[model samples]
Target: MPSESFVASRLTSGNRLFPTVVEVTDSAVIRRRRTLFSRSEESIHLQRIASVRIETGLIWSDLIIESTGGSDPITSHGHHKADAVRIRDLVTAAQTAHLPAATEAGPSRACPFCAETIKLTARVCRFCNREV
Candidate 1:
């Protein structure tokens, strides 16, 4: 379903004002309205996320979403603590649900002799040259 799970902005005049919003969705985390000069949205797929970090303040919080690819983390500042927490939890759950290839469920089996990945019908471990 469509969602407006969070809106983070630069707070001014001691009040909450949302100039931009971070959208949480089933498959992606999107930050819309990045600049006035151009319409740009940053979207991070759930499968690529490495971690979601929240830094809390007295009245506001910041979120840093890191990727597994070693690129720069997406940062959203001036979010409410509850909003930040919700975003963190949502991202974490999505990341766990959408794991990468190394952790993906498959038909391959582990070789008992060398603990290497092997086909289900394999009789020998190719990497270790041992009987499976």
Candidate 2:
């Protein structure tokens, strides 16, 4: 049973030990960065996602995926804005699809404020920070 996966480009040469990349799997979201002699990866399980926030800048964007069970969030920085947005959409879709039936209100609807897809019952738009 193959699953869905999203990975960023890792071919940017000439950047020293900071060969960082973003990965999103059916089960988790991952951020990996490597240095001269060390490499680190942060992962956030899809089922544990409590909230996701993205901060967009002119040149780069930051992604933060907070967990529901009190674990540290998986954060990735300096990614292209498009990539950050894509990550958020993927994670949100996965969460909505995997959530327990008891917690699901119904099919999700588009947020009127920002037009970004969000849960049908959501009162706040995560992308535009507006009332839904």
Query: What tens digits encode model 1's per-residue C-alpha lDDT throughout 25-78?
Result: 988888765453566678787777888899887887877888887777787778
Query: Candidate 2 lDDT (Cα, whole model)?
Result: 0.73
> lDDT of model 1 at residue 26?
83
Root-mean-square deviation (CA) per prediction = 5.4, 10.8
Off by over 4 Å in 1: 9-18, 99-132
lDDT tens string, model 2, 25-115? Answer: 8888877777788888888788888887988766666778899989888776666677778888888888888876675556788888777
Best by lDDT: 1
lDDT of each: 0.75, 0.73
